[model samples]
Target: MTSQRAPLEPLVPHPRAPVVPQASIIPPPPLPPPAPASGPAPPHVFGLEKSHLLKEALEKAGPVPSGREDVKRLLKLHKDRFRNDLQWILFCAELPSLIQEGPQCGLVALWMASTLLVPPDGVPLDRLLQVALERGYTAQGEMFSVADMGKLAQEVLGCHTELLCGGLGGPNRDYILQHIIAGHPLLVPYDEDFNHEPCQRRGHKAHWAVSAGVLLGVVAVPSLGYAEDPELAGLFHPVPSTPYQPPPLPEEGFSGAIYLLSKQGKSWHYQLWEYGQVQESNLQLTDFAPSRAMDGRAYVVPAGGVRSGLCGQALLLRQHDTSH
Candidate 1:
């Protein structure tokens, strides 16, 4: 007998076919607006409160001698002490007289500031030089004020930075001390011939050095330091065994100023900063008071804030009559 073949199942649609929803024409709700960015607040004074304290600092700021003989004497007097006192020191490798890289004290200062602030995205010195050159800051070459360099930095770094004029007795002495305490390195311009010495080369024009830090009570040198902690003391690698003594207080009328950069807070808030330049007269005199020129104020970058280029209007006045 032939086996019965299985009957073929008749075709039938499933009772539960997948349902298809009709497409809606309504649009999704719009996203919420972004939160506004916080910016620097108003400028305020920090550290010293009394004006007389600044006056005393000015009076005590002795004149720095420039003659090769005086510089040798000063270094001789302080050599052993500098190594013993400061935790570390910094000296620029480029000297204005020797370097063909244009007047680069300001550029060096910008590098120091970038290093000190330790910004995660800080630019390198060569990049800074390129940006500065592109920005026309180096047009005047070495004659360009530290203020101009500061302006260039403000743009490149996207922050507020400025140049403050005066010396030991200058009006902004108090202000300079305040920022240092707040952990800002100062770009000090001094008569390269008179104030800065022991460099491979020295010149009649101004030179820049970074005031890396300030010693609270132990005063062996001026406001800057290379190493932050006293316990980790060692000679600065670049300028090993070199003695750094700030020239005596600047003369009554000085031309250069300290380079300062403004810091942005989580919100709107800014700090003010200053100091003055070195004078040719300071090289000759040892007993003269801080110059009146140091008292004059100079603002090269005005001030950039949280938002980029906020201080654009302030920078319209680029060159200052810095020849004090």
Candidate 2:
């Protein structure tokens, strides 16, 4: 009986629940936009005024002091004379196109006059005049008659004899002649102008080489002896007609040179170089606009002297080390 009762109690039914689908509940948190990248702003492009300010700061900061007072004095004097002479040249260069001829001739004359007044250590005014006359006469196919050229020399010499007497004498004449020969034949005698035709027509190597040398002289003169291991004198020495070539560009170590050209209806523009490589800069004719071209307006970097950028509307020379 007990077994029967237990079986009846087991018959009770079990409760069941309905199934519900949950929605794809939460969407991914919206991805935050990628953070913007950040860096330092570009450096301010250098300008003339900025360059000047920087130069002044560097100068004020001081450099390795040159030891000799006399050397400093000589350099100062040389710089002053160079500035003055270059100014005179640039001033003469500004006349009407018709008188453009005057400046080059004027430079030649001035060089002669300066030589007469302050002949360098070994050169004499008379001898320099003689050499120039000989070259001029030779170009004309006429025998050099010192009398003719001497007249001009005499006038200059007479006017500046005291100055010319300074170093005018022996080996300096030959030395200067060597340099003149090395220089470009920018001024050819009217008769020898035809000789240059070959160069103009065929692109003569001699012509370009000489031109380069002359340009070197022009650019290097102001900076000579201002730096260590000066090569201005060597640069001015005429290249031999043989196979000898100048030292490799890098080896030559040309610090750099500045060239200024004034365009018609435009401002002055400059070209810069270092070890024969041109440097790119934003400065151009528009940068120096409206000012007429002047001779002494150039800023030269001395052979090994340290300086960055040039200043002055006309001509000014200030010594500052740029080797930093």
Candidate 3:
């Protein structure tokens, strides 16, 4: 008995894909449009105009007064207030600073903004959460939509809101300086670098804060406490309460200087921090660039060592219009 076998057939290319001589020459399939990201929609999605311009102004650097005395002096910041600066208190419209338990920075920021109204509001955190609920801002009652948070400020606090974002954690310095100096309290949506402070040393979280005003060249932050929150019970950074030394007299000698080394092309430009202000310096340490400058003679802070959650994204909370 004998069996018949089938004949071989020629290969053909699919009509959609043309044959290429080599697999390497063939193009890969187009990637699916990135799935709508899990977080809040951008400001443009909520109908805000956009523009392009220069925003490079930075704070005038100054010696933050070297001492183991205060926590503000530790962060390479020329000046900042931890909890109870009179200026920050006034800037917060006489409202108390807020602290979040767990992850409620956004709600705390909104509550602070509410105080700008006449008779001084006391918008409860629960109300803000309710707003978040109605706006679909939160998923599972924790994470929130930054866009909706902006809307929450406007809707709940009754203020005109203008949103801005830097994408990268660092914002346009001018935007921070301009809005803060102009007395517009900004509700900034940011990521808390847990490692920015000593105790929490690890990850980052999507958070928010109130930039109450500018305190001594640095942006004054009044709300959303980290180091100062007692409720956390040492789970977070503790408030620095050691005695800080007062400024030295002329005979006591100059304390030292703060230098801001900004990267320019392949080299770094040195900006001198003088008398509590940043001044442009033509300082040419040809042999000692910032990359090689850190040797403990001066307290050295690298570019990566500094970050600000507030400046990255802002929702400016303009004072409520009394005329209307």
Q: What are the clash counts of all predictions, listed in order?
A: 20, 13, 3
Models ranked on TM-score: 3, 1, 2
List residue ranges in candidate 3 displaced over 4 A: 1-94, 117-119, 140-143, 167-172, 193-203, 216-312, 320-324
lDDT of 2 by residue, 1-324 (tens): 011101111212222111122112221122234444576432211121324554465346443122122223333544432222221101001101101111122223223223213333113323433443333321211111212222333343332111011111133222222222232111111101132211111111111101111112232333322222232222222223443322211112223221211111000111111212111111110121112123233211112211111110011011122110
lDDT for each candidate structure: 0.33, 0.21, 0.34
lDDT of 3 by residue, 203-294 (tens): 12334445544322212323343233233221122133433222111111222221111111100111112212111111110112232133
Clashing pairs in 3: 60-278, 61-277, 61-278
Model 2 misplaced stretches (Cα beyond 4 Å): 1-146, 159-174, 177-324
Clashes of 3: 3
Top candidate, metric TM-score: 3
What TM-score does structure 2 among the candidates reach?
0.18
| Candidate 1 deviant stretches above 4 angstroms | 1-102, 118-121, 140-143, 166-170, 198-203, 216-324
Which is the better candidate, 1 or 3, if ranked by lDDT? 3
Give me candidate 3's TM-score against the actual structure.
Answer: 0.40
